[model samples]
Target: MHIEVAKKSLQKNNQEVYNFLIDIKNFEILMPENIDKFEVLDANTFKFALSGMPEIILRLKEQHPYEKIVLGAASDKLPFTLTVNIIATSENESEVGLSFEGEFNAMMAMMIKSPITNFMETLSKNMDKIA
Candidate 1:
């Protein structure tokens, strides 16, 4: 499954947003208000549980300086990647977007499509918090 959230402009520059996202702990600020549990396991990993979702562990999979950050699920049972793309629009402003790609069977994909799409959109909307 692949899902892309709408991009949003941030008040901060691309480098600032990139720096904030590089630290896994900063993700807490971007999480929805319904988040029930959250913990930074290390510099590049975190565990979190939403109101009705199972606990998920995510680890940093790749980074491209101020351009992008990719995070992958820690377990193969639900393998997925969430990519954060940053584009500098000016000296002190930028736009950010979230894209999710997952490996799931057709039946499972149908079951998760809505919730996953909502989750990605929520995260993208929360991108402005980085400022």
Candidate 2:
């Protein structure tokens, strides 16, 4: 399944936004306020847990300089990929968007769809924090 959250225009340029995202430490600011726990394990990995969800470990999967960043779940139990795409609109402005793609059985997808979509949207909305 794939879900695309709302894109947001930011005052910061794509390079600025990309720089912020490349640092794992900044991910905590993009999580929902109800996040249970957040930990940056290394330069390219982080783990976070939401209220009642299992802790999720995400590792940097790929980066396209100032264009995009992709993180993949470390566990196959809930396989998913989270992508942040940055599009430069001007020298000092850009748009940011988040997309989530997951592989799950029908029953599991049905159960987690709403929460996952909400999570992605919240993350997208929080992109302004980088500005």
Candidate 3:
């Protein structure tokens, strides 16, 4: 499955966005159903455990200190790669764009899509709040 989302935020620039990303890694908060745990591995990397599910490993592929951050996830059921790029439009305006693509078996695809979609939506909302 593939999903893309773009949103505008009031954040100043890439630096602010990068800081927000770091905060996201540390925050224990969850979106919908509440994630079981979130662990920060290092700058730009983390591991996540979703509620009622095994841990999903996430690795940072590329990052530009808020300008853009790309992440890849590998798991038992659905393995996906996603890139999130944040662009500064002005001193106090920015936009976030996300692109996700992955291959999923038929059975897992159906079950995972909805939740992942929901997660993305929640993520967008969270980013908006920070912005």
Candidate 4:
């Protein structure tokens, strides 16, 4: 399953957004308001529990400098990849997008598709407003 969330112009530079995201502390603003718990286990790993979803660990898979950030589920139980792409549009602004790539069984995909798509879209919109 592949989900394209949102793409929009961000107020900050590509490098600035990239740097802020590398630190999990800033991720709170990008998550849903009802998230039960979010903890940073390490510099590149964090675990979060959504209101009605199982807790999952997301780890930084790779960094493509100021262009992109790739994160994936640390547990094989829920295999998925979250990609953040940044393309500079001006000196202090950039076009940013969030996408999810996952492999899910037929029934599972049917269940999660809408909720996850909405979740990622919300995250992407909020991320654009970050300074």
Top candidate (lDDT)? 2
The estimated TM-scores of all candidates read 0.96, 0.96, 0.77, 0.94
For model 4, the local distance difference test gives: 0.88
lDDT of 4 by residue, 1-131 (tens): 99996587887999999998887767877888889999989989999889988888899998999999999999898799999999999999898888899999999999999988988887887885575
Candidate 3 global CA lDDT score: 0.70
In candidate 4, list every pair of residues with a backbone clash. none
Which segments of candidate 4 are over 4 A away from where they belong? none
As for model 3, its CA RMSD to the true structure in angstroms is 2.9
Report the error of model 3 at residue 75, Å.
5.6
Ranking by lDDT: 2, 1, 4, 3
Of the candidates numbered 3 and 4, which has the greater lDDT value? Answer: 4
Candidate 2's residue-wise lDDT over 30-76, tens digit each?
Answer: 99998999999989999999998988999999999999999999888
Mind giving the per-residue lDDT tens digits that candidate 3 earns over 32-97? 447877788776567887787677777777667867777787453566887777888888778877
TM-score, candidate 2, is: 0.96
Clashing pairs in 1: none
**Which of candidates 1 and 4 is the stronger one according to TM-score?**
1
Candidate 4's displacement at residue 54, Å, is 0.9
Which regions of candidate 1 fall more than 4 Å away from where they truly are?
none
